[model samples]
Target: MGTAPATAFDTEALRRGIEGRDAAALLSLYTDDAEIRVVDRNTQPSHPKIVHGRDQVGEMLNDIYSRDMTHHLDRCVVQGDHVAFTESCEYKDGVRVLASSMVSLRGGKIARQILIQAWDE
Candidate 1:
């Protein structure tokens, strides 16, 4: 019997990146042409904030991780070329944020992601 092949996505690295607030590490998981669509109170489903390319995504990640907040990778599940994860964050002022993401992988790197987030108002 043949053994199952290992998946290319690194969940441990993802955990470290998210929990550690390491934007660069997280950015490394994406392909050069990767894209991210974000939906939140400001950017509703009808008009999501779209970030294209690794550079743009990096900028967003940097902005997010730079905030005075704590982040936790709550859950992650991977299947074939797809991954889904939940993240929770708390700001210094006690505002809590929750985010869920679904990602599509291509050749071991993230090709596209859809992120939905909500926070205490």
Candidate 2:
């Protein structure tokens, strides 16, 4: 067959995708069956709960943009097909929070994502 493209996820590319708020680019990073879990800082297990799915992930991002005007990635680490990062942002309501996210890539597309708040106060 032909040589395969790199299977690794590029942190910088993903950063640009997120920072640029490019939904198509962001979606392109994810696999068809990608899983995404998000736990809001103020949310608990008993509450509405974590979000899951590729489309859901996109929806969440859209919802976030509906509120927050901007979001910035502070740092990221890429290992094999996985990437983890920390992001800081202020919501449209002016609430600031730090979020830690872990992503798994397969065939150069994101296969899963686990995100949680990374703050004590």
Candidate 3:
């Protein structure tokens, strides 16, 4: 098969996908059964928003795309099949979010991901 995303550009692809609101490119990095857990100001540390499979992920991404927001990737690190990054997103409603995410990759696709955020409430 192929290798690990052709030297880390895949992470950048994810960054661009989010900033550009391109759900297809963003979801392309995930495996079919990939799961994402998000814990933020709305979501509690005790109970995170969990998404299973590509369909759910796509739906969630679409919801995010529907929002009038701007996304920026601040920093990223890829090491030993794990990737981590920090992102900031600002919405037209004056909500600003800073998220830190960690992901596990399998066969060049995201197998699991967790995102924790701090935002204006």
Candidate 4:
């Protein structure tokens, strides 16, 4: 089998994606049925959940991005088709996290992405 694409996903692209609110670039990393779950640190009892196709992911993220005051990508590690990273962001509604995620890629796009976070817990 041929080797995978040398998709060197760095902090810049991620930063741009978050700061500039580029959901298209962000969602392009995922597959058609990709899922993203963000456990909100600000909420109690339950976290703000997001799901569905790539379009929903974009819409959810775009909503947050539009109202976000600050977004910072703290750390990232990319290994072949997998990526693990921490992102810190705060919205006007007082939502935030130093969130970490593990993303598995298939055919050069995200097959599955899972996120977990621990802050003020």
Candidate 5:
């Protein structure tokens, strides 16, 4: 029997990227052609906000990490080429946001991701 190969995804790096608010570090985990679909109050399940390509994803990450907020990786699960995680954030004003994400990995990099999020209004 052959053993499975080790994945390149680094959960520790993910935690550091999110907690440290390092957009570039997070971006490094994604493939060049990665795609991300986000669903929230404004963008509902029927119509998700889609971001394609590393450049676009990078722009989004930069915008998010630039905000005056604190982020924490609540939970993370990895199974083969798939990963799921929950993240919580709090703004300076006390507003809170929570997000859950499922990601598909290709060659150890994120190829696609679906994220569902909610925030205090």
Candidate 6:
């Protein structure tokens, strides 16, 4: 029998891919029907940018990959098929963003992710 896919979150690979801004690598970890909700200072708790499916997610990923910045997974906690993590990023021109995410996995791929972020003005 084929071994089941790993449900455990691979923090190292995830961190490396994000830090390097490899959108493809990031996308590879998501399911085809994955959804992502993004909330920032502009998009508050009530109103979030909801990205549905891999195609839309790909666009968002492309945007991230286009940015000239450094990414780091500051902290992470995982239980079962869920994970929560804080991300720190410093972009060019001295802009810094701190983000936190709660993610759910399906079939070892990210099925949903909710993110909240804040950037220095």
Q: Highest TM-score: give the candidate number.
A: 5
Where does candidate 4 have its weakest 10-residue lDDT segment? 39-48
lDDT of 5: 0.96
Candidate 4, backbone clash total: 0
Candidate 6: Cα lDDT at 108: 68
lDDT per residue (tens digit) for residues 83-109 in model 3: 999989999998998989899988768
Ranking by TM-score: 5, 1, 6, 3, 2, 4
> Mind sharing the TM-score for model 2?
0.75
Error of 4 at 76 (Å): 0.8
Candidate 5 C-alpha lDDT tens digits along 37-94: 9999999989999999999999999999999999999999999899999999999999
lDDT (Cα, tens digit) per residue for candidate 1, span 1-121 = 9966645899999999999999999999999999999999999999999999978999999999999999999999999899999999999999999999999998778999999999999
Work out the TM-score per prediction. 0.94, 0.75, 0.87, 0.70, 0.95, 0.91
| Candidate 3 backbone collisions, by pair | none
RMSD values for the candidates in order, in angstroms, are 2.5, 3.5, 3.1, 3.9, 1.4, 2.7
lDDT, residue 90, model 6: 93
Q: Top model by lDDT, which number? A: 5
Q: What TM value does model 1 have? A: 0.94
- Rank order by lDDT, top first? 5, 1, 6, 3, 2, 4
Candidate 1: regions farther than 4 A off:
1-7
Better of 1 and 6 by TM-score: 1
User: Which lDDT value does model 3 have at 16?
Assistant: 89
